[model samples]
Target: MLTALGLLPLALLGGWSLHAAGDYKEREQERWMLDLARALSSAADAELDGTVATLTTLGSTPALQNGDLPALYAAASTLARAQPDWLGVILTDDSGKILFRTMDSYGAPQTAAPADPDSLNQVLSTHQPVAGRIARGPRGRAAFPVRVPITDAKGKLYTLTAVILPDRMVRLIERQQVPTDAIIAIRDGARATVARSRDQKGRVADAPSKSLVELMRAGPEGIGTAVTTEGQQVATAYTTLSRYGWAVIVGRPTDKLRAAAFERMGVYGIGIALSLLGCFLLASLLANRIVRTIEALQQGAAALGSGAPLTLAPSSIIEIENIGKALEQAEHQRNAQERERAQLLDSLNRALASHQTALADAREAGRAKDEFLAVLGHELRNPLSPIVTSLDLMDFRDEPGNRRERGVMRRQVQHLRRLVDDLLDVSRITSGKLQIDATPVNLADVVRHAVTTSSGQQISMSTPAAVWVMGDGSRLTQVLNNLLSNAERFGSSATQVTLTVDATHARLVVSDNGIGMSEELMARVFEPFQQAPQSLARRTGGLGLGLAIVRKIVELHHGEVTVYSAGAGTGSRFEVTLPLSAAPAPEPCAIAAPHVEGLQLLLVDDNVDAAGAGAALLELLGHEVRVAHNAAEALDAVRQKMPQVAILDIGLPDMDGYALAAAIRHQAGDTPLRLVALTGYGQKEDITRAYEADFDLHLTKPATVADLQRATAPLT
Candidate 1:
């Protein structure tokens, strides 16, 4: 009678276990479907985000910013060719007039408007990117546009759009490993199908069934039963992308899901029935023995819980013995895991310490490098000052026979100066301290100045009367000179430079017929230390920083530069485009040397060569000059003879130029002394400091005769 009573409870427990198994299976399937929906939603968002980013980058191009439709068309064509999933790229005015399309050739008239004008209007109103609804695109294929706004140089609004084919989204959905019978679809905000796992191309743009639409409207994400467009009822899981209001729906047929649950329940029921029957038979045969074994197991389990060693006696039943063995193995594993965790923690601490140490070392190394570059620039500029002064003096003398020699010497000096300047500019650019002064500048003047500075090259020039742009004149001239010098260094004897102006942009092209760069060399040509291969002599000598500086400067001015070559020995071409400015070009003025002569001046420099050369040049320019080698000498000269002007070098042996200037002022209490600071420190901070020290003028080293004439002109 006791066995019969126990069998009744066992049967009840088996029935409960079967029901629980079926419930668990259904819940598990629902969770899996939800996870799959979330994954698909994330994938779709990523793809759309990529398209938006690409459109943003394209809109920022100088061609688009300057309203150069042909250039923009070319760029769009290249981009479309590169991306197979892009159906076309179009640029339109705010009124939906298509200005250019990649599907059409350059300058081709396009009358067809975009399929989705609401998205373009949204972009224009918000000035942000928008992903449009799927529709029949211009080519009669179903696609969507990813649109971004572009404000041109004149502040006119335009929309740049990339039409994306639905196949990409279809591929994204198909890549997910889902059940064969499952249905997956991505729907736009309007409930139109964008992509579906089954017959995507055919079902695209179709409206979802009423039931599915109701389910989607219920919440941002949920699981429910809905009838698909195909009239099949499914258990659907959906998640909405927050950015674009798109939905990723994953569903399995309701009948199939129910069938799976029922199958699991049946298997569980059969297993439970067999287990109950076996237990009953065992109870009938050996109930007393089983009872004793159960009591022993209870004791052993309690002992293991209390951290006591397990001790189980031999049992006739193999399953009971195996259970005891498993308990013992669990204890061993716990202890082993504790030891392993401690070791792993120690290793992680050591690795973290090492990483911190490496990071500190790298920072220290960067500081040291910056300091070295500063000191090197100062040291190199001191010698060049004397050389440049001497060259100017030679020109002033106009010795008849040495014209060619003087020209050669001047060119070499200028080259060395440029190299030093490039090094300093690189340091500034790396530290994010390089700055430009923007004003209305003419490209014709820039070309003339650059050609004069880069004299030896046979450059063919073509430019309009005036092409105005907004940038730093000196920096723009530097950019052109670098290109000219690069061509001369790498090209054959002949180089050509051309300047063309459109309505909103100016194009500067420099071409050279020399040994062209290989594809590998061209890839990294703008990197700081990248250079083409050189022979043992290295006839073309440079630190390989010119082009890097060019790129940085051009970008700072909101411009673009590119290089092209067909192949080796086929020549090379470089193009630079900058937005045009409406500001009119300034009238040209001829600056002749000031008529100041025979003014009493004191020149102070620690370097004897620099001071002597400078004094000689001043004397040749018809000025009476006294040379001083230190601040004390300068002060003494001021006391002995109150000069009209004092050219002070910042770095001196006894005292700096700032203090010396103050002393000289005190010595000549009421007399006006024009203080000119001529030093190798040309950084912006240094210039600011010089002005703060009551100096009348500040000139960097290697000043030309023209610079000196202007400085002394005020004194006269």
Candidate 2:
């Protein structure tokens, strides 16, 4: 082991050097492809620029201006043959009438113009060179129309059409020194190939490969690896021609790059293999010496292990001498080990006792806290029923003053309800009992509902169509309401709140120009009971659970919320992101609207005021209403006449609402009664219990008249 360790670093260094060499070669190959693409692009641009410039000078020739038609035709024909860049030249007047042509039957010059006279009109109108679409040029091959408009000494406009044949382009490409395996293609504005250095058989005007076309469409210039037309993987670079909207693509086969890399690896691999050979030689020599010493040590250890005498052949090595001495003191070491074992056992026992005590205390504290919250939530919500019912009674009276007071009262009740709901949610969440109903819901309607419940805030909404997400609509509305309310209180106004939805994400951004949070406050903004510092005038004392509850609810729906602030008094922005649903929320199955006439109904609640007020409200709605204050009373009333609907409160003097629901179901036997549960205990577990007891629906206490009406009217 020691000999191996001494030689290990040499092997590692060699391996690392080989890797570095291979990476360097790979980078060189990539850079080579990019450089080749740039060079070919520059060459193509120069060829086009050179041809256009030559034609512009020719367009100003004096032969054409002197009205010497024969002389001009001879000069143009000589120019086309001498330059090899122009397939032919057609001289056209401003009216697009072709008068002279230079190419005929077998690409030889001719006096008659071609039948098609369509290429000169654009240059005549714009007075600028326009790259015409690719077409069959004079040499019976694909060509580009390079048109230029010029005025002679008489100031009469004349258009000169110079067709650039692929033959000339082939000459330009031949001048470029590219690799044999590489492909360089130039495409005209219409994506038809002007020249391809490595073209396979047939088809002069074939379009470029799909990969090259896709890249050119996406961006001007970039490097990538894609399959070529021949299905070989290659590294490529592409750029659009600057003068015209053509594309130049350069590609090198990936196999070539790999071959270059492998060659580099071979060079480095030879050095590593030699170094490894030397390392193994050194290790073998050292291992032989170490093996002899180990054999002597092993024999001595066997004698000592068998309880024989601690005698052996002595060595000059100091390490072996120390081992021999330790073997002689083996009896003493055993006694010490036994003492340590006893002490370790004692220590472990004490630690175990302490851990058990702490765990027990922690569990007890949790139980007490949970019990306290449950009692507090129930007691607080019990008194709210009468207040909400009284507000409905004031609406019936219809006095202007009473309506104003009732509105104020309703707002306060909602505030109280939110407070109670927050406390219960926090407790339920920590205990892992909170479950959210996930269904596709439209975010716009949810935000609008939340806005209507607000008081002193300005809210402007911008929504694009319908953005849907999978979550409980009511809970999502609560999240929006919390954020909006906070902005109204601590922020400038609701107008700064903006909600937007993209293809796959919904964002709710609320900004405040009011007093902002400090860095320290922002750090714990989502911690329960964390409140910002407040002055007397700005004191809006809350339980500080709003943001905390918002975070928990959003997380349950697979979303997150982030808050940003510039510091205290500089304002802040809160943004929430949730996954978008593919389809809009499914609308509730429509039930035929219930008849306005009276129907049999039972109102059951332990609170006399709640039962009496609900019964009065039902009687006014043209229903034959029966009232009860307990489970026994409600069952007795139902026995007299089976009502069409039974509204049973979960909390009762004799038994809970679930037991009563079960009893009513059993007694009714074959008869169907629409059982609706109304209670202050509106936790998830309570709802589950109600359903288990055969209740068709569950509604929390202080439900609106509309809610009760919907419950009482059975769906037909």
lDDT of each: 0.86, 0.76
> Which digits, one per residue and each the tens of the lDDT, describe model 1 over residues 133-175?
8987545689888888888888898898998889899988879
TM-score of candidate 1 on Cα atoms, chains taken together:
0.48
Across 276-298, the per-residue lDDT of candidate 2 in tens digits comes to: 67878887887777678779888
Worst 10 residues of 1 by lDDT: 1-10
Q: Which stretches of model 1 miss by more than 4 angstroms? A: 1-367, 400-404, 585-594, 714-716
Please give the lDDT score at residue 236 for candidate 1.
91
Instruction: Work out the TM-score per prediction.
Output: 0.48, 0.47
Model 1 Cα shift for residue 627 (angstroms): 1.5
